[model samples]
Each structure stands twice: as structure tokens, then as C-alpha cells.
Target chain A: MAGDRFPVEATHIMMFARSVADDNQIYYDEDYAKTTEVGHIIAPPTFVQSSAQFNPNYFLRPKVGQPWFGSGKEPTGVKRDAGGGGGGGGGGLHAEQHYEYHRHPKPGDVLTVTVRPGKTWEKEGKRSGKLVFSETITEYRDQNGELVVTARGVGVRTERPVDQK
Target chain B: MALKASQLKVGDTYTECLVEDLKRTQLVMYAGTSGDYNPLHTDEIFTTKVAGYPSVFAHGMLTMGMTGRMLTNYVGDGRLTKYGVRFTSQVWPGDTLHSTATVESVEDGIVNLKVETRNQNDAVVLSGYAAARVDS
Candidate 1:
């Protein structure tokens, strides 16, 4: 998933930090942040994942006037064939995520994101059945076209729900 | 404060309580902010009935984000150059998480760390590594 303009904002950062239960002043208080070595408010390390908010086609988000997979009356809004895995309701699980930061993003910086398919593989699992994994590499560049963050994400589709241990 | 290479050792470790009794509301907050509205994370009816899960679980990114808090707290703001993780297990509501970052090496004004997060059950939920600039 990618977006053309992922505008970094202070409020969004604050909310994101709160969701993770991080009370770091650097994420919210600008006055306190100025005393730090970075001397500015900085987004959390995983904040870039919020760019999904800007991705127009992000499947996880329910589009306006479109059918969502979440429950409404009969448990789900969308119908699926029995045992037909991999389409909606998250379809798969997040297997891994990696990030390389060229520099921490600050508010007012507009980022452009691009994504490319990486690799696909398969493995047998004990809890789940066969696992199919796919990778995507995303690049976030600043308005000046400088590469800011390189993110690699892997998603896995299992033949069945992972058997809880 | 930033970590100093001179004061650091290969085996030094830093730990933090990432979360205590993680609430489902926190998961909803994360899903709202991160734009990952996947039902498996917030819809119990859909997750349990449609998805066949025992209940809705926390998103992997949420655990990673909490773990990132621990890393940045240890290494300092804007210090991390690289961070990565593999989601080893599912995190459920009411699960308390603790994270640790162990100094793996100090070289050329940089520190490499091995990171791990575990639930109250002592199960590893996330495993990863991080690298950051350290003051010499």
C-alpha cells in the first residue's frame, strides 16, 4: 500500500503515541522537545505505518458506500464461501515489519510513498497449515525527494486460523 | 538522553514495561489512528464467529509500536537508524507486555541491539533488532 501525500502532523503523532501507551514528551510537547538533542518533535519509529491513512486503496479501511467485512447484524457484512480464505476480514496476518530511517519525520513534512512487491515464499506450520508469505518494500520520500524511510513488510496467509497454544 | 558508546557494553540490557493489562479500547484506538480497520483486531463478533478466532487480538503493529517506545526510551529520541521485528505470537486483550533491548555490539560510534517483547505468560510475542547512533 502507498500514498502520494502522507502529510506528517503533530496531532496525528500525539494520538499515535497515545495509542501505543507511550508518554514520551518528545512526541507531544514541543517545549519539552526543544530541550532534547533532536530539538524538535519527532514521529515514533513505527509512525510511518499510519501512511495507510493516505493510501486510497488500503483494503483494511472501509471505503465510503462500500461493503465492509466487519459485523453489522449477522456477524459479517460480506459473505464468503466456506473455507475460502484470503479475501477480506484481514485476509492474512502481519508476519514481519522492518524500517530504516534516514531521518525522523517532523510535522509539516509531506511524504510521498511508493511500494513494490518483494518476494513470495511458502512454509509448513504446526499450528496452522501451509503458510504463504509475501513481501512488500515501501519507500517514503520527502517533498524534496530525499528518501526518508525504507519499510519492508511481510504478510502471511494461513490455511486456517492459528491454533492457540 | 543519548547512549554513550564508552559507557555501553556488549551485554548491557535495558527493559521497560510496554503495556499493562492491554485494553481492547487501545486496540480500537490503534486501528483508528493507524487506519488498519481490520475486523480481526476490533470486531469480536466478526473475529470469533466469522474469522474463527477465540476473540479479537491486538494488531502486530501495535505490539511493535509499543516495543518501539521501549527502544526509543533506551536509546533516545531520533537515535534509531534501523528497527525490525517478526511477530512470533498473537497478543490478546488483558495481556501485559514487557520489552527488552540488549546491547549486542558497540562499534564506530554505533550500537546494535537485540530486542524482544514478551507477554505476562512469558511468551515471546515479538522478536527483533535495532541499531542506533551512540555518542562516543
Candidate 2:
């Protein structure tokens, strides 16, 4: 995901924390957060993934007046190839994710996102068919251009729907 | 409170029940917040009939986010310097998750940990590692 300004807001952080079932005051309560070592409210470890909300062309999100891939009057709004995977119909599934934090993001930090392709490889799987994996590296830098978080994500596309055990 | 390297040992571990019974609405919440509106995570008909799964499942990132709570609670908020994970298996509704962080080492005010999240059946859903700043 690439964007010029991904504003990290307090309410978004609160909702994101709630969705993950995290009740930590450091995410919501400023009073409690002030007493912590960070001395202020800080974003959760995986919170940067929410930057997808700022990605205008992110395919997973349905656009207005556009045919979405999800269900409507039928099982799906659009026709897809047969034998596609359960997650995204050859769009692939997330296989792995890694993050290195130069520092935890705070509420007011406006981050600039830059993405680059990493690597690709293939592996035969017992449960699924030919597994093709690709990686992407994303860097989140603060307004001052200091690297805040570096993220590496791997996605795998299967030959068909994975066989359930 | 942050962890102190002087008080920690290589084999020390901390665990938390991340979720008791996963719900589909929680998946919706995560999708809405994370902007990952992939139908597989929130659409039952599309998932079961079109994509071919028994039912809708949670996003791997959701599991990681929940597991992060466990980590921050152990190492203290804003203490983590590195965290990574591999999606081992699918997490479905009604599954309970338990996450653990085991201290692998502590050196020079830094602590490295082995992280793992298991379902109620003891199946590993997410496996990972993390590093954090600790008091000397």
C-alpha cells in the first residue's frame, strides 16, 4: 500500500483495538497512558496494517457503483473461475507477516507509506496444489521521514481450494 | 510495567487467553477497521458455496492483532521492537485462542521471545517471535 498521508487517529486506534478484543488503556485512555513508560497513548503492535484504509486502490474494498466480488442476490456478485481458493479466488492468502518498529506510532503521527516487491517462490503442498508465494515490503515513515515501521508480508496462491483435513 | 532483563530468565513464559469464542461479527468488525473487506472473512455464502470452505473464517491479521495484545501485556506497552508471525492454520468461529510468549534470551536490555498462539484443540494457528526493550 502506498500513500502520501496515512493519519493515525485516536478513535481509529480505539476501534482497531476493540476489534482485536484488546482492552489495554494505553490504546484508549490518555490518563492511564500518561503514567506508562511511553508517556502517551501509543498504537498497538499490528495497528499499521490499518493503513489499508488509506490506500485508494486497495482491491479488497468495494468501490462505489462497482461490481463487488461478495454476495448480493446470488452467492457472488461476479463470476469467477472454477476451483479457486476460498480466500480470494486466486487473489492469494496471507502466508506470513513481519514487522520491525523503529518506534511505536502515536495518535498524531502522519505516516508516509512506500511499497516495493520483495521475492517470489513456489512450493508443492500436500493439502493444496502448487503453492506460489510472493512477498511485498512496505515502509512506514513519519512526517519527518524517519522510518517508523518496516513490514514484510507474504501471500500464497494455491492451484485450487485447499483440502480440509 | 516494563520487564527487567535482570529479573528475567531464558525459559520464562507468559500466556493469555486471547479470545474465548470467536464470533463472525468480530470478523466484520476487524474487516471494517482494517479495511480488509475480503469476502472470505465475512461472507458465508460466498465462502462456503463459491470459494469452498465449511464457513467463514477470521483474517490471519486479526489473529496476529489479538496475539499482539498478549505480547504488549507481557513486555509492556510500547516495549516491542520487533514482532513477526506465520499463519499456521485457519481460525474459525467458536474457536478459543490462547497465546504465549516465551523468553528466548535477554541481553543488553533487550529481550527476545518465542511467540505462539494455539486454539482450544491445541492446534497452533499462529507461530512467531518478538523482541522488546527491557529495564537493565
Candidate 3:
């Protein structure tokens, strides 16, 4: 069974940070952070993304059932043969990432991250007739569980064409 | 009122200073800290031959971190409302990063800043905007 996702404590954020780097005083220095407009410490722009480490079951799903994925542990789905036959063979690759933040995350701010899949479709290319693209969305919240940041990332999945070697 | 773009007149700039870490040790430290193992940043052969870079380089976030530090140091901590940037160019080791900010506009207590980072080569390594609310 999967464990329930908990609110991200302030200390958790600091722990993931590389503290020896003096450049990160904003996250570690409460006195320094109080002087800023947000009036508290703030996480780096990519802080939200770096804050959480997801289990492989969630991340490695797209690569399963494809030859390029090399024997993953997930249960196999139907594979489509590229030649319009019965065999399905393909894999996934990271395509792009985008982030939007409403405010700087600070100490004492409890965070909850929710992740889900987005668009999925297939298209034909000059060389390949049908290729698929999948998108995923990750949303973050603050102590009161307020929405603060949203990230959407895309991945590309390709299946070999039926006629191609 | 939210920070307005119309408040800042063109050409308002603030200069920020950064101490140089010329030994390349800081770059190595940043690599270890950030967990970014791109060879173009840490490997000499990969950087020189594959990436065509002159030498190892700092992580993009290292420069971004320096810029954020500059903002907090300038406006005082907790004053920044939102800070963001788009990585534009590469910064090699031995490159000194200089962070700069300019008032783009202010409205409804919000101040918009045009921020940039320059290397010792005087080339902009990253450029973008930031927003924050000033005391009412």
C-alpha cells in the first residue's frame, strides 16, 4: 500500500538543500529572510520541483512494456506491433518542463504536492506514422494548503513503425 | 494595488557585488551540492570536446542562487515576492558572476525588477524579471 503524502514541513525543504553553499542563506537564515518583501524565507524558484522525490512506480510507468525500457517490474499492458501487427514496442523520453509560482515558499509553510497525467495522443511524422505524447501536471500547496505553484511536464513515446526494420 | 509595469521608467539600474571564487573549488562544491552531474559542467574532456566549452562550468542554479542572494541582501530578507529567470547562456569556471537589478515599474505596492547576471567575460549568463511588494 502507498503511504499518504504529508504536508511538507519547513525543515524538510532545508534538508534537501545543499547548505554548505553560502548562496542559500534565504532558506536557512530566518533573520535574513525577514528583511525581504515576502517577510519570511523563500525557496529557490525550482525549489518546489526539487522538494519531492516520487517513487519509481509513478515515474517509470511510461517506459514499461516497451523494448527500450528493458524488463521493468510493472505489469505489462497490450503492446501494438509497429507493422500494424500484434506486437507493441516503444519507449518514453522527457520532452519539456514549465513552472509557475505565486509566492516564495518559506519556513513553517506546510506543503502538499499532487501529481496527475495530462494529455495523451498519437500523431504521424514524416518517417513514423504514429508517435505518442503524454503530459503530466504537478500542483503544490502551502501550510494552509493553499495552491502556490503548478508544473506541467511533457514526455514523448515512440513505437517503431510496422514497415521499418 | 499590485506592482505595476508602468511605475518604473526605463534605465533604472542597481549594481550588486559578488566576491570572486577563482580557484574552481566553488564550482566543484556547487556540483556536489546540487547533484547536477552534467559532464559539460564537471568533466574536462566532455566540456572541451563534446560540449565545445573552454572549461568546466557552474550550474545555472548557482548563478540563480547568487542573484537571489543579491536580492535578499539588497532589499532585506523576506521582501521578495516572486523571483524567477530563464537560463540564457553558459558560465564557465573562473567566470565571476555579477548580479544586477533595475526598477521596471511599481504600482499598488508591488515593485518589478529586471534582473541579470554577467560573467567575467561580460556576457549575460541569465536574464529575467522579479516582483515584490514594498512597504505600503
Candidate 4:
């Protein structure tokens, strides 16, 4: 339950779609969905984004006990962190996202998730100077060990913490 | 209700806007369904006192999830090549999110879109896009 072993259930897919107000037939409507290329009810394109849920240690979640940029001193030469996407707040903010879908997630599919820290660099921002950008890539694999999706995200953290509350 | 990827031309727009509430229950359901159970999205006391937020807000993925519907429902049963978003502002309960997606370019049998999502005050809360391959 901590990591890996994410069971893909039809009900969860349907509910996830519904939670976002998306009722696409491919996610439900078994009869119609079967007529599509997937031949089964499938998860949406961003479904793999939920892969973080499978592992509590997955980055991007709150209170994961990891040293996030802006929370502490900058690592020597800005290293690539493969895990620990901890507690997103001001200074460290999610800036961009990307997903490459090899295939749609289907019911009964057990997705194995892996998170790796990619490139971390710095730049200047107009409002928030010295913005450090970090990229975290999460990969999802199916039961047959085929790549299903890859999600790349960029988080921008300012050098100084700005509190609104 | 499905269109071939070839049929999707640049400038095609998902005119039917998507708007939804950031309900606490909806966030709870997402936690149970997605298994990301971060208290910042559920526990009011934890988010307010501990995390120093005004209240429990929706997950950034939840915003991406909602904005994603605009594309999925429009593309209908088409295959998705890519979908993503940048979480700009905190989505609080009762905030009405409005979303839109426009076809920016089409190439190599793939359709690219420009997406915009704003809250009730017309402030951008999320920004991203999608690319999907179509079949005849």
C-alpha cells in the first residue's frame, strides 16, 4: 500500500472521472466503450497522474519528510532528486505538467509507479526572483510490464518564502 | 460522436465551457479513489493551523482532473496523446472553476490544444494543454 500494487478498478476510474465532472463513455458505458479501439473501459489521459496515490512516499504529497527546495539550503550544484515530492507550498510551486500516453489505463490493470527527480535549475522571475525549477518524472507500467504513461512535471520554487496567510 | 484525428483542424474549439465546484466531499472521494490521502486536502484543522492555509483546498490533480474533462468530453472517444496542467492558485471550496480548450495546431495526425481554466472571479487558476491522435 505504501508503493506499487496500485490496482485499477472500473469503479475507481468511473468515480475519478465523475469527481472531475467528466462522464466520458470510454470511462463507463461498457457497451459503447467496447466499440472503441481500447476494447474496454479505460481511464482518462491524465489517469496516471494519480499514480502518486499508490505510494505515500510518492513526491508531491504533503508531509512526506523530505528536504524540498526553498525549505532548506540548495543542494550542491542542484542535484536531481529521484523521489520526495514533498509538501507543495509557496516558494515551491507546481509550474508545468506533461503526460505522454502510450495506452489508456484499463480495468483490472495493476499499475507500477516509479518517481525520479530530473533536472533542477534556476532562473529569475519578475515577481519572484531567483526561481528554482525542478522536474519530477513519474512512470507507470502495466502488469505485463509495458509502459503505459509517463508524466513530467516542473515545480518552481522561489529563493525566499512568501506567506499570504 | 467521435471524429477522426484528421477531422480535427486548427481553430476547432471546445466551445461548451466546463465549470464545477471545489467541494470538500469531491476532494474526499478523490482521496479515497486516487489514494493520495494528504490531510491538506481533507483535514480542516491540519490545513488551517498546521499547514497555514485558509482551509482545506482541492488537490492540484483535482483541478487538472476537472480541466481534463473539457477535452475528454469534446474529443469523445478519441485517443489521447498528452494532457497536463500547471497549478497556479489554490482552489478553495465554493470556488467555481471555468475551463476552455482551443485547437492550437494539428500535425502528424495529432491535434494540439490551448487550455485555460479560470475561477469565478475570472482569475486563471490552472493552465495547460492536450494533444490527441484521432482515428477514422
Candidate 5:
């Protein structure tokens, strides 16, 4: 979710809500939502998480052509070529997720995401020994350039698994 | 939505929503909708053989999405100023989760809540907090 702009539209919001099976009226009915606290139809709380779909620079888009933990492809760290996280030996899993929202996102908002550096640590696991955890922090700013949300996505790579490809 | 700024107080426990089932199709649709093709979440074989899991599990975002549903349903839209959660366990195919949001505090027309989601077995799988501006 670093340095990519995601467009907020009713379609994406509706699809995300449907995919997750969230029937909250605030995400749907405009007339009903306006009668509530928000006064307008707005996205679900985690709707900002959908930015991964449009942000090519998102760290965990796929195994093919995404960024990796120790990959030195990006000399400057912010700008890098695609396919660093690509290949046959990739089995990273999202371990934890946390989000902070300044405002509920609505349609017609353009948000820019920027990935900031975070800490990395090691923890021993029962199934996978000595796993390494990396936390990547992402910030999304609205079209007004005001910050709307900040997300922390943690990824885990197992060191004990021999066939983790 | 029984919460009102004037009537609310600290230690008030209120609101929950079922997280529904963890079906394979739900994960597939989420991968398509979210563009996260991570094999750990989408590929059954890869999840079993490579990641050393029993089967493909729901994306952390999927559970987080359910948690979001719980939050929005409780405080309504535009009230949630902050919400965050941590995944503690894997959600298998038939598992169901339910989360409750409890009022932690009240100040300046804002309601702060501590939220926790548990599996059918009463295991806490996700826990977090949310702060909402409930002035009206």
C-alpha cells in the first residue's frame, strides 16, 4: 500500500461489502445511511484495506511481481522494479492487521497510500520454528491530502518449513 | 445502536454481529475483490503442502472485514474514528465468530470501545479497540 492511489467508488465499496458478507446499511442505502449518524453512505471500517487491489506497489499483492522482505531490488527502498517477491519460493502469510481511521471513507475520494518503515522481530513458533515477523505501516491520505487511515500489516515467513514454496 | 453520548458511561458492554461462516468461496471472492492472490490464503494445496496447514484459511483481511462489520453496525457510520484488530488464530471452513464492543470510556462527545471476537470454542481470535464520535 505504498505510494499508490486508490479510487473510492460505490462499486468497489459494494463489492467489498458483498464479498465480506457485510450487510451494514451505512455501506449501502444512501437514504437510510443519511438518516443515521454519518448522514451519507460510507464505506465499511476496513474498506481502506481494499486499496491493495489498485495499488501495484502494495507489498502483498501476489507471489508474482511483488516486494519481499530482504529483497535489495529497490536501491532507494521506495522505488523498485516489480517481480522482487515473484518466483517459486514464496509462502508469506499475513499474521496481523491493525487500522486507524480519521474518517469513514465515502465515494469520490481519492486516497494515496504510503508505506512507512517499521520494525522487524523474531519469534519461535510451535508449527514453524523461529519465524520472522515484519510489520509494514501504510498511510492513506484523501484527495484533500489529509490523512484518513493508517494500517499496519504484519507478514510472517516460516524458517522451519522445508517445502514452503 | 443503543449507544448515545448522553446516556453512555464507562464499562457499558453492548453490540455484536455474527462473523458468519468461513467458506472457500468467500476467500476466493475476497482474493478477487482485494487482489491479494497470496497462495497462503487462496490455494488449498499450497496452503496444505507448502505452508504446512490443514487447509486454506481465510485472509486476515476477511476476518478484519467481519470485525469492521461489527464496528459499523454498532456505532453506525461516521462515528468510528479508529478501529484496529489482531488475528490470533486461523479460521477454518466451518468456524463461526462473534464479536462484542464494550464501552471503555466517554469524553468530549466521543465513545471509546474495546472489542473482542471469539470463535465457537470460546477462543479469542481477534481483539482490538475503536473510538467513535457519537455526538448528536
Candidate 6:
């Protein structure tokens, strides 16, 4: 669990603002941001996923299954098998993510993010054997401790066979 | 003055683009700021040896942000009423992302549009619909 003591910076906010294609002057223009309800440039809803507060080692590479990569360099470091003291395993894939926003994100506002494992279950698939679906609940709050957004999504986990695309 | 929903025809199109480094440094920064630490994005060995992805990739929400920016820029403020998206594919580092929207339908004061996010290859990475209220 992280604290509000560490707030998100302005530069990162701006970077994410621009990254979400065609960000408007309201997010980049100081004059516009000052007059808006948020009183500062607000971040796009999509920027919620960029937070670095959570440790990637836990969610990105769970040791139970292998993650499917399209075609890029492989990720390195970290103990891939640290979950429950099991032998190292494979990676997983993000199946879906959904976000609901209460208010637009603004500049100069301190944000505190908290992430928790939402749920875990299994289901049978056509092509794949039994698949595991994991969901995580991510909540974002403003400097005043108001709930700004809530995101819940599933990540599909399965073992990567040697010759499967 | 609000644009009239009746004026927007189906099949209308809008586009935009941006450039940035989608490297681990930025990923780490986002993870730290956003509280998303999925190893498929930040860890290499875990991604390769375990996950089997070629390299770490960008978060789906990061791509969706690009989609939202397109709408805000196309129609200006107070114009976008409702927006939603479904992630269909994964985007990797250094991949140039492009977003576009096509008008789908309009009823009464409501206007519908099809929003899409594609990579350099023009593959539809994310596809969904958007609804906005036209000021009469």
C-alpha cells in the first residue's frame, strides 16, 4: 500500500497528456486549465494506467504461466518464480481494461493511486485448455481525497507452448 | 454555439498523431505514477522466459488516452458527451500510434461515431463507438 506523501509530478502528467493523441489546450494551456473546473490542466482518462506506484514484478510476470509476446525483445531481471515459492513459470496477456471517470484530471493536483487484486477464477476455452482470468481493482484519488476514477480489467493467463504463435 | 447533431453525417472522419519514447524508463515512470506494475510491460526476462512476449509493451490505457485526445481535438470542448473503447490488441515500444474517428449515426440530439486506434501498419488496435450531444 502506497501513501499520498508521494504525488504524481507535472512533467509526467504533461507527457501522458500529449501521449493520448490530440490532447487539447485545456490540458496543455495554462490559461484554459486555470479557468476549468479542475483549475489546472487535467490528465486524460487513459493516463491512469501509467502510474508507477505498483511493483510490476507482482502483476506483469506472475510465475504460474507464460505471457504471449508479439515480436520484441524479452523482459529481464526480477524473480519470475517468487509467487508462493513455486518454480519459475511463464507470462500472461491483458485481455481487457475498463475505466470510468468522475472528473477530468487537472494539473498541479496531487493524485494517490491504490491497486488491489480484484478476483481470480477459471473457465474453459475453445482453443486453449482451462484458462485463468485475473482482475485487479485500481482506484485514483485527488489531493483532497476524492475518488476520481476506478478501473477494473481482466488479464488472461496460460502457459506458452514452445511453438505456439 | 454547439454543433448540431443533425449536421454530422455518418462516415465523417477525423485523425491525429503524436511522438514519444515508449521505453522502459517511461513505463517505469508510469507504473510508479499509475500503480500499474504488470511485468509484461516492465520486466524483460520475465516477459521472455515466462510470458513469451518479444519485449515489454505499453499499457492498453496508454493507447486509449491517444483515442480520447483525438475526440477532444476534433470536436473541441463541451462537445464530447460520452466516449468508450475496447482494447483489441497490444502495442509495443517505439510503435507509432494513430487515432481516427468515423461518424456512425445521429438521432435527435445524439451523434454516434466510430473511434479507432491503429499502429503504423494501419491495423485496428482498438475499436469502439462514441456518443456526443449536439447543441441545438
TM-score versus the correct structure, for each prediction: 0.96, 0.96, 0.59, 0.79, 0.83, 0.67
Interface RMSD of each: 1.8, 1.5, 10.0, 6.1, 6.3, 5.8
lDDT of 3: 0.55
lDDT (10s digit) by residue, model 1, range B1-136: 8999999999999999998999999999999999998889999988998888888999999999999999999999999999999999999999999999999999998899999999999999999999999999
Model 5 bad stretches (over 4 Å): A57-91, A161-165, B15-17
Candidate 3 iRMSD, 1 decimal: 10.0
Question: After superposition, which runs of candidate 1 have C-alpha atoms over 4 Å from their true positions?
Answer: A1-3, A81-90
Winner on DockQ between 4 and 6 is: 4
In model 1, how large is the Cα lDDT of residue A136? 97
Taking the tens digit of each residue's C-alpha lDDT, what string does model 1 give over A1-165?
Answer: 545699999999999999888999999999999999999999999999999999888888887998877888878787784322333333599999999999999999999999999999999999988999999999999999999999999999988888886
Q: For all candidates, state DockQ relative to the true structure.
A: 0.75, 0.77, 0.11, 0.40, 0.39, 0.30
Lowest lDDT 10-mer window, candidate 6 chain A? Answer: A82-91
Q: State the lDDT of candidate 3 residue by residue for B1-136, as single tens digits.
A: 2233454555677677553654456655554444443343455653343333456666566666667666655554445666666555656556667889888777777777888878787877778777666654
TM-score (0 to 1) of chain B, per candidate? 0.99, 0.99, 0.79, 0.88, 0.91, 0.83
What tens digits encode model 2's per-residue C-alpha lDDT throughout A43-109?
A: 9999999999999878789889877878889888876753234444444789999999999999999
lDDT of 5 by residue, A39-76 (tens): 87788877787787877555555346444322233211
Ranking of models by DockQ? 2, 1, 4, 5, 6, 3
Interface RMSD of 2: 1.5
How well does candidate 1 match the true structure, expressed as C-alpha RMSD? 2.0
DockQ of 2: 0.77
* lDDT per model vs. reference: 0.92, 0.91, 0.55, 0.71, 0.72, 0.62
* Clashing pairs in model 2, backbone N/Cα/C closer than 3 A: none
